[model samples]
Target chain A: MHTVTVQVVRPIGDDIQKKAAERSAVLLLGCPQVPVQTSIALYLLSMLRKKGIKGIIAGNPAARRLVEVSDPDHHYVGEVIDIDRCVADLAEKKRDFSLCFAFIHNDAGVSYAATIGSLSGGSLVALIYGEHPEDVAETLTVPCEKIVVKATHNPMPLKNKIDEVLPWVVSNL
Target chain B: MGCLESLKYEILLKNASSKESGDFIRNHYDEVHEVEAGYKILDKHLIGIPPIAVGVEGDYVIFPYTKPCYGTFLVRVAVPEEVERLRKRSK
Candidate 1:
């Protein structure tokens, strides 16, 4: 049974988590639709589902990215260290053919997330960008071999933009 | 040539690669309203010297490269002839 983990690099906020889950779930459906070894796990620092997750690391950059898009709940899931532990936590929750993705748009601290994903043994990378990001897919190859670089060159706000495009992206993914 | 060789050659290669990358983002910032963009190209070739590397030979153009894959250079994607036919149809 082939198992995969989808890790989207973003701040752990209610909106981002929800969007990430939907995006991950959408991509999950594309995985041969096989029941065997099929599981979906999310690597996020959300307060709502904190107890449900294991292998929680402190100071992990992915957590920082999640922090940037924090919601009004004042319940930010901050500080995760020991990257190896985070990977393990994610691995434990892994299911077969899991599709991890991120919703990073207009993020100033995007480079760090890219770096973490590269070093974290990620198989696939879904780069979310607005303007052309100067070959981000190539930059992220050090940690990941196969990459699915998704760029949104549309000038609409991401929330509205996702509505128009997520359906297509989800279907193809 | 001998003196040049003996001297420490720390030439500041004028960070063209990153400059080009920044320019791409700035110019198309509004048009591509997302935070970033992706470039998909095929057949990018490169050759480098032992110590300090240079020259990124890609499918279309060759330019100086400082960093390995992240270096900023023009990414030329060759358009298939069928697409060109479609463009001519509009004219």
Candidate 2:
């Protein structure tokens, strides 16, 4: 039988041990079917790093590949764990994250965000966009901070929204 | 590793327990793949819409089942000879 392993990829930087335990964030991508999700995830990862918060992006293989190929030269995508494994680890208390940013464009995305946010014991921040902002918000059952920008198929519209949410990262709240 | 080796699912619906949900999926899906842990509740991929994420790897299918109360399950399902042959050619 072929075996699948759920290994945690530590964030890159000096003081790796310290950063892993400190203000950490988990960025979850819904699916690679939407190109914009990767863009927004990478953008948020950069912002989080700038604020001294080490972040890890989690998603299925396709979604992870989208981010990986985008920045082959720089470790822009950084570390990732399988979405299934990540949730299991969080539930088991094997890994801890201080904040969670989930890009929600569909029902699966909302479920993912809620699972991670609730397990992380941190702020569950939902990034909502696309044609229907209110509609998507209504689908989310878990309590979380929302970053809504009404843009479909394009990540450009989210720059302002990302800026607005930057303080949350800087404050590390 | 025991949990990962054998597949399980947790039922998320309030009215139904994990045992009830697991029975329903088993009856519907034909076979339960080998997963590491007990089944978790992942009733809905969307609001009121229950869907499962299945992963295809070689001759095996990876099923992601969720229970709202527990977590998610990563189960590996093996395909039969004829089905595997068809899957190979279709790819």
Q: Which candidate is the best by DockQ?
A: 2
**CAPRI class of candidate 2:** incorrect
| lDDT, candidates in the order shown | 0.30, 0.62
Docking class of 1: incorrect
The structural similarity of chain B in model 2 to the true chain B, as TM-score, is: 0.30
| Model 2 misplacement above 4 A | A1-21, B1-91
Error of 2 at B10 (Å): 15
lDDT of 2 by residue, B1-91 (tens): 1243353422223333223444444555543432223124231121122232233445554444443223344344454442354345446
Among these predictions, the greatest TM-score belongs to 2
What stretches of model 1 exceed 4 Å from their correct place? A1-69, A72-84, A90-97, A103-125, A130-132, A140-161, A168-173, B1-91
Candidate 1 residue lDDT tens string, B7-62 = 23233334243434444434532322111111111211121111112112121112
Model 1 residue A41 CA deviation (Å) reads 16
What's the CA error at residue B2 for candidate 2, in Å?
Answer: 7.9
